[model samples]
Target chain A: MRESRSDRIFYMVNNIFLFIILIIVLYPMIYIVSCSFSNPRSVTSGAVWLWPVEPTLLGYKTIFENKDILTGYTNSAYYTICGTTLAVILTVLAAYPLSRKDYALRNPIMLIFTFTMFFGGGLIPTYLLMSNLGLINTRAVMIIPGALSVYNVIVTRTYFQSTIPIELLEASQIDGCSDFTFFRKVALPLSKAIIAVIALFYAVGYWNSYFSALIYLHDREKYPLQLFLREILIQNTIDAEALSKGQMSIEDMAARQSLFELLKYSLIIVASIPVLCIYPFIQKYFVKGVMIGSLKG
Target chain B: MPDNKTYFYIKKWIDKNWQLTLMVILPLSFIILFHYVPMYGIQIAFKNYRAVDGIWGSKWVGFDHFIKFFKSYQFIRVTRNTIMLSLYSLIAGFPVPIILAIALNCCKNIKFKKTVQLVTYAPHFISVVVLMGMVIQILSPKYGLLNNLIKALGGEEVLFMAEGRYFRSIYVWSGIWQNMGFSAIIYISALSSVDPTLHEAAIVDGASRLKRVFYIDIPCIVPTIVILLILNLGSIMNVGFEKVLLLQNPTNTEYSEVISTLIYKQGLASAMPQYSYSTAIGIFNSLVNFFLIVGVNTIARKLGETSLW
Candidate 1:
């Protein structure tokens, strides 16, 4: 049937509205990329608008030369890798047993895990516990306390229950395959998609975390990239207050200030690149994870 | 005779399922150590905890810390700020994603829809620190994008971050920008599962696209919407602690201080940490959150079919 004029008008208007939203979302991202490439002076002078003005690599060069940023990058990488690995392993170990129908204590155990999601010991007690255990200001502070997530366990358990058949477990058991062998040889291999989803969730979480470090860590060398970014991007705004105190020459101040402005843009892009790079490849898995979670698990 | 029989049954169950028992041991220990241990340590809230005396040895000061928190001047400010910010975010941020999901569902062009989805979802992955960095850059009075636009339009530049009044709007809107796309995914999937025949039947009945969305699409997704709304209501006290802390400065502290940040400052960041008092404040916050979730869940169960439990 040929479309009515009113229906056509509706489609046209809807598309335009969506297009405006598209611009609203894309503009900041594009402007950030453009500002990162623009010359420091041009960036500070507001000459760069939608694209690079007198493009240069000085911002990235300055970032690369900063020792603190490099140390932070290495520390963040170490934390992400170790934390994700531990979290995935622990989540799977918890989820699989809870998924089994024959597991005698699944209900109470699951309740034990779920209760923590809504209520916790709060900050002071957790901190005191961490300190009492001698984890303060150590590398273990980054990984150990946050190894298992109850939400991920529930999601992964739901995946296992829906996708993995109990008949297969019964058959394997009849053939003398123990539960350990079945989990190692059969369940893990078949559940790669859910595993990938859980791993990505944990990896992104570990990469973006800074609060634990802020509260627990006192050493600069142990700081994550986010802590460093906080210092540079947010705390550095205080330097303007210092500038009014006349701590440096005017010319030197202006030059240093411009460089810091450009560096902020570059750092935002550089810091987000790791997650953004892998996002497209794993986007479907994330959608699947969310869908599985939304189900009444 | 009954005790012996019960013991025998327990032994047989453990023997038969010992592998499952072994699988849970490590994770169970982790939960006990990390989660349950801290809960046991919550007794510090009632004690005048000293490093030398330790948690157990400290003198009991029952309800003193909680009373102090209630009577303190900072209490009202932080509580009001927390509730206002959370309510503002919920009221403003909740509807955008539902509208976006509905709009995306209405569009028939596959390529345009896919592009919109991809670009919108990109910001959700950006970390909070970087997001605040971007916000600061865009809102800077000197040499910032908004400032530049204002100057070009013959308007005066405003210090967006420094001012107290702009804090809630900035926090809520930036949150909506970052999360709207990702949050819409669940609703999008819910819409996709909607029966096409419903729309076809509506079309046959002379319904417009807008009318079809109202009559068929929305009613089909109401359960999903209700479940999500319940979850959001349950988390009203959370208020995105890290982002708020990152955005807070001495100038904006009056508007920006929330319970979680206050807890951090008093317990960890202060020169002389007030461990017991901070713990008391934390307990109060958690109790409110717990009651809020339970109360909301109860209401939801009574009024609707979907409840978290």
Candidate 2:
């Protein structure tokens, strides 16, 4: 088919519009990276725009040296790994049985699970309950209270129902396979993709979460990276507040302030490094997970 | 004889499916412990809750807490803030992904399209703390990127984060920037499922790409759009609480103190936590959210076939 002149104009306009959006999205990411690497003085002066100006590793070096930051990083890593594993297991435990057509109480059990999605006990009650259970100010508080998400359960169940055939179950049963054996050997192995997706979801949630920590944790030792980040980045406390009280000379204060500014840019990059590193490998799985979830919707 | 027969049948069924029951037992226990138990504890909202007295032992205060909350000055401020922010987000953030998806769909250059998708989606994975950190850095008055840009352009520097008026735009637009690509994935998938033969047919009939988008693409994805819109409306009461809390400062608290943040403050962050009063506020928020979702779902069912249930 021959293209018309107007169609050419439309294509040109559409491409330009999308290109502008692309820049809008990409510029901040590029600027932050550039600023993180640039000399603190250059960054504070806004000389580092699209590229690094007088590049140095001082920002990253400072972040790595900070004891609080290191402790928080370790805590976040622990929570994410432990929490994700438990979440995935619990989600599968709920989702798989509910997926089975012959499960006697599937519908009622599903209703019980889904009801939580609509309403909850809210903050105070939940907090009180947590305190009563002796989970407050503990590492278990982060992992246990939020182990199973009903949304992920539904998504996994939908995946199991569609992908794992009932015929396979019946055939295995005739071969004298028990339900537990079938689940262990067949259902789990067959549902690895959905499991990966669910695990990723939980891992990200655990890694990014701070509200749980804020409410439950009191000891600074238990603080996650995000909580530490809250102090440094958002609250602008710690060194800045401490420095003011010590009566630093003008030049020294200005120099420390510039380094603080540069530190934030580097902190953002370092904090995001784990997710960004794993993202490329799992991006396809994340897309697949969303697609599976949308099918139920 | 009938009772005995039913018992025998139940025993046989249990024997056959006990393994399945075993699989669900732990998770079921988790739900009951974590979810339903807190719900039962909600009764403390009507009681004068004390740590010594416990939830059940506390003396009942009837409607006192509710009444106090209803009469409080913070009530209107928080509710208004919550609604305005959510509505602003919905109005501004909703259509952006659809536009992005459609634009991407129309682009024939696969490499450019893939690059756009990749870069745009990257920000969504950044922790909320990090994202907010970036926002504060970019909007800082002295030596910040935006202020620097303003200075370079011969405009006076502005404290973007400090001012209450700039809060909503900054929050909503940043949210859009972070989420638009990730949210567009669903619509992009929906667009992919569009029958290419329809586009072919439209083109053969002298329909241009833009015309095909309006006449075919939009219509095909309307159901997806409607479903998502219904879902969005259902959660209108929930302004992104964490982000609001992060963005909030002394100057902006008047505009930024939504119900969730208020609940956090009243319950946990205060010098003397008002457990009962905070619980009352929470219950009120939950009820509003519940009704909004149910009401939206019902309206969707009545108006279209895309109701959540």
Give me the candidate number with maximum DockQ: 2
After aligning candidate 1 to the native by TM-score, how far in Å is the CA of B124 from where it should be? Answer: 1.5
Which lDDT tens digits does candidate 2 get at residues A1-297?
678998898888989989999999999989999999998889888897899999898888878878788999999999999999999999999999999989998989999999998899999989988998999999999999989999999999988888889999999999999989999999999988888888888888999999999989999999999999999999987654433332224367677888888889999999999988887778878787778777654
After superposition, candidate 2 runs with Cα above 4 Å error: A240-251, B1-4
- Interface RMS deviation of candidate 2: 1.3
DockQ values of all predictions: 0.70, 0.73
- Chain B TM, per prediction: 0.95, 0.96
Q: Residue A22 in candidate 2 has what lDDT?
A: 94
Error of 2 at A164 (Å): 1.8
Here the TM-score of candidate 2's chain B is: 0.96
CA lDDT scores, all candidates in order: 0.89, 0.90
- Clashes in model 1: which pairs? none
